[model samples]
Target: MQKTVLNEDHRRSGARMVDFGGWEMPLHYGSQIEEHHAVRRDAGMFDVSHMCVVDITGLDSAAFLRRLIANNIDRLQVAGKALYSAMLNEAGGVIDDLIVYYLDESNYRLVINAGTAAKDLRWMAGRLADWQLAATITQRREGAGALAMIAVQGPNARQKVWQALPDCRSACESLQPFFAARCGDLFIARTGYTGEDGYEITLPAEQASELWTALADTGVQPCGLGARDTLRLEAGMNLYGQDMDENISPLDAGLAWTVDLVAPRDFVGKAALVTRPQQQQFLGLLLKDRGVLRAHQKVVTSQGAGEITSGSFSPTMQQSIALARLPLAAAIGDTVEVAIRDKLLAARVVKPCFVRKGSILV
Candidate 1:
């Protein structure tokens, strides 16, 4: 099994480890609920070094990415600005969801999910060859394993992160959301998965342990994957394999806003997306009756049957919340029946996002 730079630190802190995407990662550090609350109420840090960071450079980088992903890369005009996009196949199926950072006219950086890193890299290479693009792709940690990534999230997240990296305060203090900046060897991005204001920092692997200790000294709770899952679910963020995959299109994955269909620019999946009918609708569900919701549970609606893509007990709301893929006719106020075990439980359809920046939306 693979391990990140902070694996030993997690073990020392008594974290329960589990295999995730072939990497042994911390599932929780006693009380997953408390960790979830920590991120919602205060500050919490997560070791996210398992994620892949790839740098693309060359004169054709910008043009290459514009044709590669569904979102319009032309929107990223400012350096350090980031754009969230889905790399789709020719059939309009999502290959992976990623965040691309605009570094310069000829350079860009992409952060892809750990599980899909290899496949995504291979697909990117094939596309480059097919298009005859002159972009060069470099996987950051392919050889020396020199990179480490960490995410600090929640209300007090930025404050504690600044305290931990005092020297970087000036460089990133004015950094806006969905933007990034480099301070010394640290690359700090004001982005997160939990719908909270925070930073995702990438630095040298050798300095990761020291940085982790410094952040802990600032009273930032160390969190694990279990809390991360619940937090993202509450925030209505989609998990790559669960909410979407090679078989699902962005239009049906609660990611239609990220797809640029109006722009005249042609992308990889444009033809198929324009031709394919959007039969499925992705929406949020709030269980009206008792019992927790889970993925793959059958959802019955007046229009048609659907399935929950992701579900969990929302720590902030203290209720079961889920993202379900239903028929196009499923409205916001419509009632649905979820088959949980032997019983059919009633649930109400709502917007996917339940919380944002610690504020309960629904």
Candidate 2:
């Protein structure tokens, strides 16, 4: 298994390690709930080095990406602007949903899910070869190869990071959301999966340990995958394989906004998307009664039956929450029953369930 540059740091901090997508990563420091609250209230840093960082450069980079991703890259006009998009197969199924950074006209960067890194790269390369497009694609998959990523998130996330890395003040202080900049060796992106104001920093892997220590000194708690999962779930972010996959279209995953159908250009899955009738819908569920929600639990509604895709006890909401896939006939404010263990628990269907930063999306 691969180990990140901060592996020793995590070990020294009493992290319980686990194998995640072939990477030995910290699952939790001590308590997952404590880490989750730290991120929600103050600041917490996550070692996201397991995620794949790929650089796409060449004369045809912009044109290449326009055809490759579902979203309109033209929307990213600024140099450091970032786009959230999905790479679809010919069947209109999502291969992966990724964040693409428009570094320049001739260069772009993609942050992809860790588990699908190898397959994603090969898929892109194969498509590029078939299109007869010439673009240089490089993958930074392992230690010191090129870059490492760290996500610092929460209400006070930005303030804490600025205190630790003062040199980034000029470039990041006034940065807008979804914007990024390269400050010396640090590539700071004002983005995160958690619904918080923070940055995702990409830097040389060798420098990751020291940077983690500096952030720790600034009272930033080191978080792990366990806390990240609950936080993202409460924030209404989708997990790649659980919430979506190659067998499912983004439309059913509540990611239709990421698809661009009026670009005046056809992408790989455009025809399939156009012809398919909307069948399933993704939604949030709040357990009204007792019992924790979990993946693969059966959901019985008045309309029909559905399945919970991603479900957990929400640390923030203090209740069991879930993202479920069901028939489109399932309406909001409907009551449903989730089969947990040997009992049926009551739950309420809602839109998104929760949103951070004072947005009551539910």
Candidate 1: give the clashing pairs: none
Query: In candidate 2, what are the lDDT values of residues 197-287, reduced to their tens digit?
Result: 8999999998899889999999999999999998888888899999999998888888899999987988888888899946788999999
Runs in model 1 lying further than 4 Å from the true structure:
none
Superpose all Cα atoms of candidate 2 onto the true structure and report the RMSD in Å to 1 decimal: 1.3
Q: Which residue pairs in model 2 clash with each other?
A: none
lDDT scores for all predictions?
0.94, 0.90
Clashes of each: 0, 0
Candidate with the greatest TM-score versus the true structure: 1
Per-model TM-score versus the true fold: 0.99, 0.97
**Model 2 lDDT at residue 256:** 90
lDDT of 1 by residue, 1-362 (tens): 99998999999999999999999999999989999999999999999999999999999999999999999999999999999999999999999999999999899999999999999999999999999989998887556746889999989999998899999999888999999999989999999998889999999899999999999999999999999999999899999999999999999998998999999999999999999957699999999999999999999999989999999888889899999999999999898999999999999999999999989998
